[model samples]
Target: SIKEKPSSKAEKEDENPGTVRILLLGAAESGKTTLLSQIRMLYKQTFTESELIHRRAYVYNHIVSSMKAILAFASANDLQLSLDNQQRAKEILSIEECLGPFTQQEYDAIENLWKDPAVQEAYKKRGNFNLNDSAK
Candidate 1:
């Protein structure tokens, strides 16, 4: 007995023709993921509450890890910090403390810390570090 070839319908089903597929590609530091996230938010349904909670936790972890790396770089390089920024960094580096729901003052302090020349330089050097793509 001879076997018959699969039909086009079978091929399409294997490819999941009903599903939309998107590919993002760009340079190392480019915002491809950010653009994809924006597209998802604009075109797809909003995230469920549980998804939002999960994402919040992930964001917090990412921020904490990034801050720690910056601090380590600063320490290794003997980077100077203003008295106020030093205090702010201390608070941010406190892993035990819960983050988010920031008060206006805390928000301002964090923003200022990020804007500091040392922090800015460190941030620019982020390309030197390797972060898992999943974290982005």
Candidate 2:
């Protein structure tokens, strides 16, 4: 009879000589960070205050970068936005000038701009680039 393969834990120990190593590889924005966060939650149970703070910063960065990309795409395509949305985009881009946290109203305004149909259409065009079908 053929022998069964060893358990993953046993195979890892054998390969690393007592040290287990996991390597995750993927393209950009391919859910690597999300996967790592899930794994961390499963194995570590909870995050420290500092880790939570760092995660918050990462989320904020993603939001800001996404906003910037949307604005850039709109401008490049000469896509017209409503006066309100235009003002909101300006406010979002000038957050550094205020040197303060965003108010709830400002956050709502940004979210609204992001949900605009024109913006969504523009985002769909991005599927022509490197983004995979799932990401699109």
Candidate 3:
């Protein structure tokens, strides 16, 4: 016999005409954004141009943060990057949130760090810690 899942608040809301509330909670990189995107698609929602622009900046910032996490993991585990890649890792760690999108230099730094063998090894072990999906 198959088990029936209990109905939750969302199902209860369908009986009346009112706002629906949902909360997503999970560890980092656990697909919260993916779930939200699915929900939006289910509702036939679309992002406005301004929202798209803001989301672009978000993607840039997430890339930087993901690199920082990988670099930190490499350092903590005593993995050594090449001198130039070490410099790139330092630059990525010190980067602030992107207001718009990443500049060319910033983007290159992340790409270089990501190509480092140390970073790649760290990425392989990312499941031991919280690293963003963008790092993949």
- TM-score against native, each model: 0.55, 0.64, 0.73
Clashing pairs in model 1?
none
Pick out the ten consecutive residues of candidate 2 with the lowest summed lDDT.
127-136
Q: Candidate 2: count the clashes.
A: 0
lDDT of 1 by residue, 1-136 (tens): 9966668875656567576766788996477757876987898867778867776765666666666677667756677767889888887776654344555655666677777778777666666665434432
lDDT winner between candidates 1 and 3: 3
Residue 72 displacement (Å), model 2: 0.8
User: Model 1 scores what on Cα lDDT?
Assistant: 0.67
Q: lDDT tens digits, residues 24-103, model 2?
A: 89978777878988988888868889878777776666666666677777777877778878888887777553223457
Show where candidate 3 strays beyond 4 Å.
1-30
- Candidate 3 whole-model C-alpha lDDT, 0 to 1: 0.81
How much is 48 displaced in model 2, in angstroms? Answer: 0.8
- Show model 2 residue runs off by greater than 4 Å: 1-30, 96-101, 128-136
- CA shift at 29, candidate 2, in angstroms? 3.6
Whole-model lDDT per candidate = 0.67, 0.70, 0.81
